[model samples]
Target: MSRHLRLALVQAPAESFEQFADGLRLRMKSPNRAELVVYPELHLCSRGAEAMTLEEYYDTYAEPLDGPRGAALGALARELGVWLIPGTVLERAEDGKVHNTAVVYGPDGELVAHYRKIFTWRPYEPLCVGREFVVFDLPGTARIGLSVCYDAWYPEVTRHLAWMGAELVVNLVQTSTSGRAQEIPVNTANAIVNQIWVASVNGASPTAQGRSLLVDPEGHVQVAAVGTEDTTLLAVVDLDRVAAARKHGTGGDSWPWDHFAPDDTPLELPLYGGRIDPVTWRPAVSPWTPEALRPAVPAPVPTAPCPAAGAAGEETAR
Candidate 1:
C-alpha cells in the first residue's frame, strides 16, 4: 500500500457554529493539498463561561451522522479531493444527551466514521460521554481508529485500537487554556507506542490554546503551531513510513504481548484465564472458579462537579 499523504490542521478561534463554519469554508477555499483536513475539537461551539448549555448547543449546532454539517463536511472533502476530519462536536443523541462526536468523511463525500469521545473531559462532566471505541475503514487507504479529547491520555485505549488494525488515529481535542501543554506529551506517547500516525487539532486564541500537532509514528511532531495564534498547520505523511517503523524494531512493532509467557509472567495472565470478554464489558473468569467469587456489586460511576453554567443562562462568551 502507498504511504504518501498530506494533512491539514485548522487552528482557529471560534465563538459560534457560523464562525467555525466560516473558518473551515475559507480553509477549504485553498486547501493544504493534503489527503486529509483536520479541525480542532468542539470547534462548533463557543468556549468558556458563555459556552452553550448541552441542550442549547445541540439544538443549534448538533448534526445527525448525515445532517447538513455532515453533508457540508463531506462536500468539502469531495471538493478538495481530500479526507475531512472535523473536530468533535456536541451531537444530539436519542437518549436526550449530547455526545462529544467526531465525524470523518471520505474524499467522495461518504461517511467513513463517526466516533464519540470516550474519555470525556472532567470539567465537562455534565455532557454525555461515549461508551465504546470505534474504528472505520477508508476505501483506498488504511483503516482509521477514532477517539476524542482526553482519550489520548490513556494509552491502553490507543493500544486497543491499534490491536484492532487501525493504521491511523485521529484525536480531536478542544483543550481548555490550561490543559494543552500536558496533553501534547500524552498524545505523543500514544502515537509512539501504537506505531501509528496521530493528527490532533486544538482551539486557538480566545477560544482555546490552538497547538494543533501532527505526530509521526516515532512520536515526533512533524508539524505544529508554535504560538497561540489562529492559523492552520500542514504536513505530508507517508503511510509507508509508519509501516516501515512497525516492520522494523520499533516500540509498538506489534502487539506488546506477542507470544504467551509462563503463567507467572504479566503477559501470561490473559492466556492463563485473565482475559476480559471483548463482547461483554466484563472480566472473564476461570471456569474452575465458583460463582461465589464474583464481586457483589458493579463499580460505581464517580460523581464530579458540573458548574451547570449553560443550562441556566444564554451561551456565555469566555
Candidate 2:
C-alpha cells in the first residue's frame, strides 16, 4: 500500500466568505480536486473590515469553534468530500477575548482539529494567545501538524509537532510585508532540520505577497515558489519517504536524530529550564526510543570524581 497523499494548498488572497465558498465549490467541481484543500490564513475574514477598530472587527466576526462559520466551513468540506483547512478564523473564546484559530474539517464535515496561534504576530496582533500544540492523524495516511503565520518563526512549535509523529506541517500564512522573503528560507530550514514536509501557504495579491511552497522531508522543494496570484499548489506527499529519511538519514547521510547516545545523562536546556533524558526524550512510540533508536552506548558516569582516590573499601561506599 502506497502511503501517498494528494493535497492542494490554496494561496488565494483575502476574500469575502461567499467568494471563498464559491471558489471552493468550483474547485470540487473540477476533475483536479485534491483529497485535502488548504487555504491561506484569514482567507475568509473579509478584507473590508480593516475600516473598523480591531476590537469591533473581531467581536463582529469572531465566533466559537462550533460557531456559524465553523458549521459553514465544515459543511463545505463534507459537500465537496474533501478534507479542508479554511485557514485561521477569529475565535471568540469563552474568556471574552478573540483568538486566531486554525481549523481542520474532515471529509465528513466534522471538525477534526483546531489550533490557536501560539505565536500571534505580537504587538500588531492584539488577540489572546493559544497555549497548546496540535497534531492530528489523517486516518490511514500520515500525521499532519498545524501552525499559523507567525508560528513558523518559532522552531519549537514545529519541532514539538515532529516529536509527536507529524510527517507534514502546514503553516497557513497571510503575510503582506517584505517579511515574507525571510519566511521562505525559514520554511525550508524547518523542513531540513525537522525532516518533515512543510507547506507554507500564503495569501496572494492585494492582501498578501503570495509565494507559497511545498518542501519535502529532505528539504527538496516539491512545489517551489509561486507568484502573488491566485494559485493552488498541488503535490503528492509520500509518507514512506518520511520513514525512510528518519531510518536512513536526510540525503541518505545526515542523521541529526543520532546526536544523543543511550545511557547519556539528561541534557539541560537553560533556555527553557528543562532537561531531556536521552533514552526517553522523545514521545512514546518515537524512533528515538532506546530499542528503536539503538543509539550508541555512552560511557558510564563517574561517581563524584572517584571519591578523591580513597581506600578500596571506601571507594565502594555509598
Q: C-alpha displacement of 90 in model 1, angstroms?
A: 1.6
Off by over 4 Å in 1: 15-22, 29-31, 47-51, 251-318
Predicted structure 1, TM vs. truth: 0.75
Instruction: Give the candidate number with the greatest lDDT.
Output: 2
Q: How accurate is candidate 1 locally (lDDT)?
A: 0.68
Runs off by more than 4 Å, candidate 2? 283-318
Question: Residue 108 of model 2: what lDDT?
Answer: 95
* Span of ten consecutive residues with least summed lDDT in model 1: 281-290
- Local accuracy of candidate 2 as per-residue lDDT tens digits, 1-318: 447889898888788879999998997777548998999898888487678898678767799988888899989889989999999899988877788999999999999999999999979888899999998877777688999999999999998888887889999999999999999999999998888889999998988999999999899899954689888877888866766676688988987665665657789999999987777544222332234433344444444444455676675895
In candidate 1, position 179 carries an lDDT of: 80
RMSD each, Å: 16.2, 5.6
TM agreement with the true structure for every prediction? 0.75, 0.88
lDDT value, candidate 2, whole model: 0.83
> lDDT for every model?
0.68, 0.83
Alpha carbon lDDT of residue 46, candidate 1?
55
